[model samples]
Target: MTTKEIAQKYVELNRTGQHMQALEDLFAKDAVSIEPKGTPTEHAEGLDALKKKNEEFATMVEEMHGMEVSDPIVADNFFSCTMKMDVTLKGMPRNHMEEVCLYHVKDGKITSEQFFYTPPSMN
Candidate 1:
């Protein structure tokens, strides 16, 4: 798959609440994920660690929907995209969040992903 395709699929999986299955197919075995602001750690490396982080996020949010992708730029094996995430927090009102995600892909799988987003408070 192309980098854009992989990025789109990632959003699709998340919107559909198929987090684990998406990780299995889209993420590399040795993938690294960086979510700078929240959770168990800032960085998670390897599939096992990444899976754990994903599960943690899934547990935190009550519902996720209305994903929109834009500004997709791909070069070589790297891609960057801007995504809007509509979600309901566990104890908060619905939110429309915007994030910029940079992806490093190889052999059609995402090897690394870095996300930049304003905190929930800012949203």
Candidate 2:
């Protein structure tokens, strides 16, 4: 898939809580994911690790909503996008947050992702 398409699909996967499936299909076997400090998951390496992280996130959040794509920038093997996410934690108030995700693509699959987000208090 094209970088833009891959980025968009990632958002779609998150929105639908199909992250594990998306990870398996869209990411390279050795893909790595980095989460900014204070997020539920910190950093993950390899597809299995990512899947476990996604499952934990799904369990912790009562509801996941409000995913919007913005500011897509794509290059030869890299892409960045800003995403808005609304999540309702199991016991905490809902969070409306924005994050920028940078993706490294190789051989039509995402090989790495780095995330930067505003602090949770600002969300």
Candidate 2 per-residue lDDT over residues 1-123, each given as its tens digit = 888888778767766767687798899989999998887677899999988987887787788766676756888889888878788877778989788889999888999999898656524
What are the models' TM-scores?
0.77, 0.81
Q: In model 2, what lDDT does residue 15 have?
A: 62
Error of 2 at 7 (Å): 3.5
**Whole-model Cα lDDT per candidate?**
0.82, 0.82
lDDT of 1 by residue, 70-110 (tens): 75687878888787889987888899998888889999999
- Kindly report which residue stretches of model 1 are placed more than 4 angstroms away from their true locations once superposed: 1-17, 38-40
Q: Report each candidate's C-alpha RMSD, comma-separated, in the order given.
A: 3.0, 2.8
Error of 1 at 69 (Å): 3.0
The regions of model 2 sitting more than 4 angstroms off are 2-5, 11-17, 119-123
